[model samples]
Target: MQTLVQTFMERRGDLLTALWQHLGISMASLVIAMMLAIPLAIWAARRPKWAEGLLQLTSVLQTIPSLALLGLLIPLVGIGTVPAVIALVIYALLPIFQNTYLGISEIDASIEEAADAFGMSRMRKLFKVELPIAMPQIISGIRTALVLIIGTATLAALIGAGGLGTFIMLGIDRNNTPLLLIGAISSALLAILLSALVRWFQTAKPKRALTVFGVILVLLAGGGAYSAYANRVETVTIAGKLGSEPEILINMYKDLIEANDSHVKVTLKPNFGKTTFLFSALQHDQIDIYPEFTGSVLETLVKGTNPKGMTAKQTYALAKQRLAKQEQMTLLKPMKYNNTYALAVTKQFKQQHHLKTIGDLTRIEGVLKPGMTLEFIDRNDGMKGLKKAYHLNTTAKSMEPALRYQAINDGRVNLVDAYSTDSELRQYNLALLTDNQHFFPTYQGAPLMKADFAKRHPQIVRALNRLAGQISETDMQEMNYDVNVKKQSAATVAHRYLVQHGLLKGAK
Candidate 1:
């Protein structure tokens, strides 16, 4: 508990930034939802026949899984804050809409008669009587929507929208319990505070209520204007996949770029789901640069490309050519390490089966059950191609990268697909099964950047390229171990590496 507190205190600045981001996204989403839902609810409340269908439609939207909904929106709206805010607004609609409809519809018919008797106009009656009486229910609906948005906003990080979810996802990837707890607890506290604030607003005097809302409006307008201005500035945005390696690499890029160049700023949108997500983000100019592997680019992104028998250099060259031609993206210098996908088994399991190669899995056949990440399970160059090459038949299940090691160790699964640079392979006493069939290609790590950005920022590119041949396989494995097994932060390990390599001066 003390460690957790210390961790929170150490990262308080980041937490506060995430908190502000969370508030902005959530509040903006709730405000939009209320605007749309209130009008729709009023329309529905007047039409008895339409109310049921309208309510059911929103209820159905609420039923879609939050992550699934975010994924679905990516292709349509692309990644980042827009899709996140849109998804949150969609999720928040049902509660607010239903409450508003109920509040207005349940009003006494005699009140309408009283308003008519007083020669009140329809709009005047709605504003003067119906809305005023419905204020409490409307406020209650807003409170519910606020809490819902706050909780769901954590998921916005998956799509590269900054929020407290960034810490939670980072903690999970690195297996740091303190970081995870901080993100979870802080988010809960924010929700609680916001809920209390809304309730207070419900009961507060008119002057106080107006003042609070006035302040919120001012803040919102200011935030929106600042965001607009920031977007126009010449900033290099680096994105990364969801793991310690990408996080480390992106941070290294940020540090190097900022150190070398005073005119431009570098920012990170870390943990942006998968390779496809990052690729899409780059192609759409949602991100300026991100670390990618040659093998993944060849096998997954560029469809129907056969990379068999290609050397690492050939693969890198091919990836560079193809990405430049197709996506207007350029691959920078490759790192020394090949963080390729490989199968691994517990030492005891390996000993029991005498499995030395991926082909040896054929001997175990029916006895082998493999667990891997979803991308590995579905990729053409992953299990599917490996199985065809080795002529092996085995049951495989899709699991998260973070859980695969534990599942293998616990005997829930016998074999697991792992990254060659993962630290857990050593800590868990696992043995890598060699790819004797040569099904999987070498994954040389490199930064994929927008061609225009590269052309404009040559010095920044030069600064990043200085790291090209520096990080060996052992260096990456040790860094991963430090983060995953030793529970060190990725930023700390990255900083140490930068300083040790003399890549940065006075890195603390």
Candidate 2:
């Protein structure tokens, strides 16, 4: 509990910013849902025939899984706040719409008759009597919608929409219990707070309720305006895949780029889905720069055939050429580390089988049950190519990245494809088999950017290039260990690396 509290305190600034983003997305979604739903509900209440169909449509939307809804919105709206808000609005509609219809329709018809008998117009009666009488039920619906929005907004982080979800995802990725607790607790509290606020509005006097609503509107508007302004001022947007190393590299790029030119404002958008998403984002101009691997681009993105027995330098050069010619992207100078996939085994298994290289795997044949990530299982350059190149006929099971090491450790699996920089290699005493056949291409880490962005920001390029050959495989593994095993934040680990290397000065 104390550790969680301390973590929250230390990350208060980031948490507050996340909170603001959460509130902004939820409130904007609620407002939009209310605008559309209330009117539709009012129309349905007035005409009993349309109510069933309207409710059915909204119910269908509500039934869609939140994650699926977010995915569905991505191509239409792109990622980040827009798609997130749109999904939330869709999720919020059924409750508010149903309740509004119920509230207004359940009112005593006699009272409405009396207002009509007293010569009051339909709108006047609605304002003076029906709405006020229905206010409590309407407020109840709003409360439900608000709570739902607050909870669901946590998923916005997956789509690069900033929120408390950022910490939650980071915590999961890095195995930081305290950070996860903080994000979960903060989100729960925000939901409770919003629920209470709505309840207060439900019971409060008319003037007080109106004032509270007004204040909320002002806050939402102000937050939206501020976010828009901040985005406008940010000169470079850097994105990265969802992992410790990518997070560290993106932060490094952000820090170095900003330090190189104070006028250049860098926005760090970490955890932007997968490598394919990053490539798409860069192509579409959604992101300016992101760290990528030569092997990944050469084998996957550009669909280029790996030259047999090509040196690491040759692989990088080919990737650079292909990226520029085919995609109009540029690969910057690569770091010393290569994070390519390699087949690994527990030290016990390695010793028992006397396995020193992938060539040795062919001797074991069907005896070795290999576990690999789903991507690697399907990737052309992964297990498929490995089998063809080495003539090994072992069937590999697709496993989650985080669980693969444990599988090997527990003897559930004998071998697994692992990244070169995976900390588990050290922690679990795993041995990487030498790729004597060299089926996997070299994956030297480098910054991939839009050619136009690189051309426009020469200084940023120079600043990033300064990092080339500086970070070694050992350095990357240690940093990953710091975040994953030691429970250190990625930002802290990244900043320490920069300072130790003299790449960044002054306390951040």
Candidate 3:
């Protein structure tokens, strides 16, 4: 409990920023949905056949899983607030549109006859009679949408759209209970508060209610303007995959770029998403650069890339060549470390089973239920290749990276597939079994950028390239440990490393 409060206090600034972002996204989505759905519902109510199909369509859309919808949107819109808001609008549409249609449709025929007898025009009748009677139902739909939008807005973080979900995702990745609770609790509270505000709006005098809503709209507009102005500088945005290592590496990149280029401001979009998400952002020019692994460059980015017979240098050559030729992206000089895939087990489990190599796992394959990542379980260089190469038979069980560690620690699983340089290996004192067959590709880390960006900013390229052979395996692992286990900030750890190595001028 003390740790939870301390974590909340320490990260209060970030929490508030996330809260503002969440509010902005949720409210914008709700307002947009209201504007679109309410008008459409009114028009459709006059045409029952069209109304039935359109309302049904929204129901179908609401059925699409939030994560799946975000994934689909990434390829089209790229990742950010735009796609997040669009998704929320889709989900919000169902409730608002359906309720409004039903509300206006359910009004008594006598009410319409009275309006007609009084010589009310179509517009006046709707404003004075039909809509006023339906106002309560409309308010209910809006309230429901506001709450739904608030909950679903959390997913925006998956695509680099910042919100409270950032804290939740980071907490899960780092296995921090406090961070998880903070995001979860904050979101619940926000939803309750907003729901109550909607109820108040329903009861308040029209003038007063409109005044408060106007203030909110003005504040939102101001925030948007401020964001645009802040981004007007010469900014070089660097994004990374989800992990402490990627976060630390990007911090290193930001420090190097800012140290060398004064006119260029560095912006680090750490833990933006997984490899595919970042790569899509790079291709769409949404981000300026991101650090990528050589193995990943060939594995998923390009087609027909075989690194089977290639050494680390040979593999990098293939990846760098293909990336430049096919995608017009520059793969910079890689770091010296090899963060390739490997399987691990607790020291006691390893000793008891006498495990030494990939083939050795076959001894306990039947009883083994190893917790692995979904990516590793599906990849050719991961589980598929491991099984074919080593002839190891075991049930395939996929899990999140962080949860894998927790499972092993809790004795739920005895083995796990892991990156060779993962900090958790040292943290948990796990033993990495040897890959005698050497099936995994070399995974040297390097900075990747669009060719156009490189051409436009040669100084940034040169600055990032200076890290080519600077960071060794030990240097990276220690840095990871610092951020993951020691609770040190990635920026601080990166700066210390840079200063100590004379990459930047600073007191160590």
Best by lDDT: 3
Question: Which wins on TM-score, candidate 1 or candidate 3?
Answer: 3
Best by TM-score: 3
RMSD from true fold, candidate 3: 1.5
Clashing pairs in 1: none
Instruction: Give the per-residue lDDT digits (tens) of candidate 3, residues 262-360.
Output: 777888777798889999989887888999999998988987749476888998899999999999999999989999999999999988988899789
Runs in model 2 deviating more than 4 A are 47-49, 106-120, 227-234, 303-310, 349-378, 383-416, 434-437, 489-492, 495-508
Q: What total of clashing residue pairs does each candidate reach?
A: 0, 0, 0
Model 2: ten consecutive residues of lowest lDDT: 272-281
How many backbone collisions does model 3 have?
Answer: 0
Per-residue CA lDDT of model 2 for 1-508, tens digit only, reads 8888888788899889989888888888998999999988988998888999998999999999987887677767677888899999999999999999999999988997899999998899888998889888888888889989998999998887889888888776665788788889989999999899888877788899899899888987887788788778657889888888898999899888888988988888887766766776677677889999988988789955677777889988999999999998899999999898998988888899888999998888868888888789888789888878888887888876777777888889988998999888898899999988777878899999988888988999999998898898999999999877887777889989999889889886
What lDDT is reached at residue 288 by model 2? 88
Better of 1 and 2 by TM-score: 1
Better of 2 and 3 by lDDT: 3
Candidates ranked, most accurate by lDDT first: 3, 1, 2
Kindly give the stretch of ten consecutive residues in candidate 3 with the minimal lDDT sum. Answer: 303-312
What ranking of all candidate models by TM-score puts the best one first? 3, 1, 2
